[model samples]
Target: MTFVTKLSFASGDRDVLAETVQELKDTLERKGAECKGPHASSPETVSVPQYKRLRAGDEFSPWRYDVYKRSMEIHGADDIARDVVARDFPDSIHVEVEVDRKKPLGHRRD
Candidate 1:
């Protein structure tokens, strides 16, 4: 039996996101754990229209920004994965982790 630790990170600040991911990858690598990736997802554009006062005829350009995401899988490294999930990160960054246990697909014949 083995576990796959899926980690996802998101942030509006690209630099902060990259730094956080890199630090995690480095820690796992230093511990000699097998890591799959820091797979990047397309930036999602988020916009919110700004309205001036309560008037029904006034509106300003929408505030626009991109949110970046990165994902990675850690194979058979439970301890390392736990440490990563437990570690503290910047308040502006968001991190999520999921653990999935895997078993052999077929019955074994002795």
Candidate 2:
């Protein structure tokens, strides 16, 4: 049976995220593992209002930041997937991984 590993990487720094994902893809491919994609989602914009302690008026501007996310799916790469999960990622980047076992057609869910 094959397993699909879904990896989601998020970071405020776009360059770092891109580089990290690219490196991961390269490593997995070099190891003869099948990597599906590093599909990028729309950048998420988060806004935070900065309020001054003394002034309660609506004079403070809100701080806005972008949170970029990239996703990839690796199939039939249990060993590589485990190594990836145990690897140390940069502090700026956040990684999430989910593993799903592939079943035969007759055993699949509707």
lDDT of 2 by residue, 1-110 (tens): 78999999999999999999999999998999999889999999999888777577655789999999999998987988889889999999999989998886777565
Listed per model in order, the count of residue pairs whose N, CA or C atoms clash below 3 Å is 0, 0
Best by lDDT: 2
TM, every model: 0.88, 0.88
RMSD (Å) of each candidate, 1 decimal: 2.7, 2.4
Query: Model 2 compared with the native: what TM-score?
Result: 0.88
Tens-digit lDDT track of model 1 for 1-110: 88999998999999999988998899899999999889999999999888887866688988999999999999997888888889999998988888998876794756
Query: What 10-residue stretch in candidate 1 is worst by lDDT?
Result: 101-110
lDDT of 2: 0.91
lDDT scores in order: 0.90, 0.91
Q: Give the worst 10-residue stretch by lDDT in candidate 2.
A: 51-60
* Runs with alpha carbons beyond 4 Å of true place in candidate 2: 54-59, 107-110
